[model samples]
Target: MAIRDQSYQRYDGPVRTGRSWPVIGWSEFRAYWRFWRTKLTIFAVWLLPLMYALLVLVEAALMEPGQLGADGPGHSHLNLFVSTQLFALALVYIARGCGIVSDDLRHGTLQLYFSKPIDRIDYMAGKFYTLVLLGVVSVFAPAVLLAGLRTAFFVQSDMLAEIVVLHLQTLVLLAIAIALLAAVVLGLSSLTRRTGWAVLGWIAILIVPLIVHAVGAVAADISPWDRLLSLHGLVGLAGDALMGGADAMPEWMPRIVPFAAIGALIGAGFAALNWRLSHLEKIT
Candidate 1:
């Protein structure tokens, strides 16, 4: 029989009953931060954003006010900066998110989590919060800050409000994009216990669709709308449209198609997460 430690006393501490997810989120966030890969990816990704900052400074100082307007390339720079971070985003997702759920399951940590007052929803919320926070810091912050910097240095007072509104709209769009990606990453992470396989699964999810779309476009001469299967393509089209850049979609395809594709992807991700949760309930 296992010996019991009689020296341990029952807790008389205050039973605080507030949201527990933030604690779980911060804990997971710290764990990810300790990884060398996470640190390196963050350091490397910030360099491009710094260059974009310098470009913004020069353009704001020298370019004509009209060039920074609604139809200007400045907005594209903002979108482009975020797009360039997608590689870094993927790296970070692999570093931290790929194992977020699987590691817990593999090591039997969920039992510990469930032993506490935290429900499955709170635990899932923490996981979502961690990935979303990563996305915001790594992708959303740079893009939005550049937008703000442009608005501050370049815009005339009369057009200030309009620019703010446009940039805010773009920011919200980017945020939605971040959340969608987070959901997909977490959902995929739950499917396997091995981090390596999770990473491969994530890669396949992003790449296989494009390969299929490419084959169809070439062999069947499919319409441009078929790109809805390509995650990268859908995001690119959505970003350009959200940035109010020139429309990237075909005239035949509705503007809503990319957004709808994003919604569908998010729904699929949630389905995966719920399926995993159901599995956990069955076993535990």
Candidate 2:
């Protein structure tokens, strides 16, 4: 039985069989829901989104008469949409994502989780979905619901198709924004064990760049489109897509440039954050 004993000793640690896409996806969703249920109360989770939806409804109500449609040719749906998107979506992402990973580390949760058979990717997947869901509840769901309400209350044949198209466009735009926000927040949180620092660092990473960009804009005579590197500018561009306006950009640059650049920053930020966190060894 010496051979049998030797064989048993050969593999001492937990064995990992990496998961497939479908399994990973479902696991992510399920884990996210579980965390959501536990962390957020019924009222906070449901009420917050509903309240944001009402804000959009109020904005629709306040819009000038006959201004909902595209017939003006000087139409400005993009501005309103971008503003609402930023206001509605930013809080949820900032709160949950900024705290998630850092809290795990500070409270010794990650060690407990790692002690189980779970992988870093799985852990990150769960956190990512949680942030995505929060964004949907706040920004996406509210935007669509409010848009539908607007279309129902004030129907205009000329603008209805455009509004509908804009609504569809919002889904894609919000998805990118939410993904970027969630990924960067999660990655940053993972870098530090202090939740407060994680959040502040996130804000600094986001805001400081824009502050620098703003100074550069004036000193260098930079075009507004170039300022899209600023946090507010990128947020505004995302909003503009929904509102159908982007006057700040140079007329020569294609409309897609701002949106694309914002998306790239978010994507790159997420990758860098995740790479940093994933490589981190536990501090005893």
Candidate 3:
């Protein structure tokens, strides 16, 4: 026979205090992985990077020193690598990251979140870091692979040091790109309650100059080939400047311009995110 023992017990648990945004960030990150769409998208994004790695392998195996356009730093493969970063990440952001803030607003969850042990900074940081992680997966991971492959393949030559320098240069470039893209999307996500609208807004901002060029709002001189004002072009320009390849950059688009423009865009992103969060705080 089982006897029921009834007694009053004091509740005891570790008090959750201090900055707790990581709690929010970590939970959100886990939830994102649970979605099948995220799994499929991640799988698809890796294919291009692996395919590009084939070129590196082929050059090392068969081609002459300069046969496969191997003149620039790391044979200009890193430059080509940068061009592949944006498109796949854009799909992931649209599928899920674009909803980072809008979903909370749509579901009326901010009040509930505020009821817990976190504030807006924590919320923003968590959300910001989530997108940055996605950027790492979509951009930096593949880059490191290529960097290592190049380093290993060219270990016997003077190009080893140059390869290391190029990798370091790209580290800076990738950081700027990952952070800027995350901020821009997160900031835009805060502006509306519909993820679809947020996605459209992000896409528009990223390619605004192209839309302008198409409608003649931009000068004819700023046609497709000469445009450097867009986000994608600015990133490429910054890479060129950092990697000592800015000689080909146009006179109008000075090297300093991309640095200044990237800074301004990053600032603008956080400002927009903060503004929306402040509005939510007032209401909550």
Estimate the TM-score of every prediction.
0.85, 0.67, 0.86
The top-ranked prediction according to TM-score is 3
Per lDDT, what order, best first?
3, 1, 2
Looking at model 3, report the run of 10 residues with the lowest lDDT sum.
217-226
Query: Top model by lDDT, which number?
Result: 3
What is the C-alpha local distance difference test score of each model? 0.76, 0.62, 0.77
The global Cα lDDT (0 to 1) of model 3 is 0.77
Each prediction's number of clashing residue pairs: 0, 5, 0
- Tens-place lDDT per residue, model 1, 65-131, is 5566545334565455555766567767876688888888788888788899987778888988988
Q: For model 3, what is the error of residue 105's alpha carbon versus the real structure, in angstroms, after optimal superposition?
A: 0.9
lDDT of 2 by residue, 29-134 (tens): 4554566543453225446446646766786678776665435323245445545565445555554556666766677765666676666667667677667766
| Model 3, span 45-95: residue lDDT tens | 888888878987987889665543356454255655675676677777877
Q: Judged by TM-score relative to the true structure, which candidate is superior, 2 or 3?
A: 3
* Candidate no. 2 TM-score: 0.67
Model 1: colliding residue pairs: none
Deviation in angstroms for 30 in model 1? 1.2
Give per-model CA RMSD.
Answer: 3.6, 7.3, 3.7
